[model samples]
Target: MTGWWCASRVPKWARAPIPRWRNWWPRGGSQGVRSSQDYVRKAGAAARMMLVNAAAARWKVPATECTVERGVITHGPSRRRLRYGEVAAEAARLQPPQDIPLRDPKDWKIAGKSMHRLDIPDKVMGRPVFGVDVALPGMLHASIAQCPVFGGKLKSVDASVAEKMRGVKKVVREGDFVAVVADSWWRADQALQKLRIEWDAGANGNVSSETIAAMLRDGLADPKLPQARKVGPNIPRPTSTTPPWSRRPARPG
Candidate 1:
């Protein structure tokens, strides 16, 4: 939307009442979305684009005559123009359009092109701010601690000392994970360190490095056994050769 309005020369005032609706992502979404291929937008985004075109119609120009770009909305070859920010209030007052023109591949311009992304400039300047950077009034910080040993269950936790510590707001334990909420991140970390926790190692208590090496040695000698990288508990040891991939230094985070 910013790109479209900017090309149209939309003034600051014309941008009023834009984003009056919440931009909410629904649950059940992929939490880790780092690449462009993982991107997903809701149906509301489509409706918002329709509203942009509908706003132009309210100004006596049909969508076909108007070109919205860089916050500006222009009409006709002579390029008679109105900024989107100028029409924002009136646009908010108008009813939403029932339908929008379905975009044809022929109409595509910027999307999927090799052109520079909108956020590149800010990112290059180290000035980009993300959602996680937002700070609300009286908002607290949290620190989480997870069990280091997999398959181990949290047996007990004593939080009385943590609760009495200064700046410690709350300590929460759910399943094997412990969360510390405090006035600041440092305080939360302090509280987390103070927590006295015990874990039930169960069958894992018997597992050891020597045992793992022995299992690895056995796994390599067996011919019919399926090849695998990890030698988890309960897998019968077949040979001693260490996995080739383990020879490399650990990958940095």
Candidate 2:
């Protein structure tokens, strides 16, 4: 749910046989599933509805007559119902359909332009659950220190002092990437400051903003420089030496 760490090795829970179902569940809470349509939030509510339908099937009730509302599965005519969670044990015994029938969009209660968003309440309350909000027991925090320049590599790293710092768990180094793991994020940051790292200057070692501006000026003056998708004929760019205010007024011909 937090990335791919909790994925089932054997995927496809809905199509899997009764015994082989991997008990798939999503841990992203409400905000993790980013569907603009508010139907399915986390565990594919449609599939969960199907599980309710599967349970109602055992009672010889037609699925068309059966309706699921807020995890409660209700049968028609008799109005007999059971919470979906109550029938989960029984649903596990029954195999899912080979071809699951989709609910008609017109009949869907939640599918409409006027349908209200589900997360608006949580967002207003400032408690909207997101992937970054995930916190588990015994979870470790990691912070990475990357090279300043792109495509740059670390020439050398001295992390001996960082290792001895408070709450510093471990220091990992791979190519230009260096990470500090610790008991807390702030402690790891403190440890990072203790370490001294040297980076290998790449091709742009001597390059600066001034050098780039010069290159642009040189390219503008080149008559052979191919014109890109321009709207009109190319005009010479203003030179650094010729300020607009300092230019002499043009004399009449």
Task: Name the best candidate (by lDDT).
Answer: 2
lDDT (tens digit, per residue) of candidate 1 on 1-253: 4345124222343433333336642333563222211111222223345545665567666667776666666776656777666676666566544453344546656455566557778888877666556679999988888776657777888988888988998998877778789998889989888899887766677777778777766666666654453367557534335433455645421
lDDT of 2 by residue, 56-147 (tens): 67777776777766666778678888776677777666644445345566755543446455668879997965655667898777778988
Please give the range of 10 consecutive residues that has the lowest summed lDDT in model 1: 34-43
Task: Report the Cα RMSD per candidate.
Answer: 10.5, 13.7
* lDDT, residue 25, candidate 2: 41
Q: Clashing residue pairs in candidate 2, if any?
A: none
Q: What is the TM-score of each predicted model, taking all chains together?
A: 0.46, 0.49
C-alpha positional error of residue 154 in candidate 2 after TM-score superposition, expressed in Å: 1.7
lDDT, residue 58, candidate 1: 71
lDDT of each: 0.62, 0.63
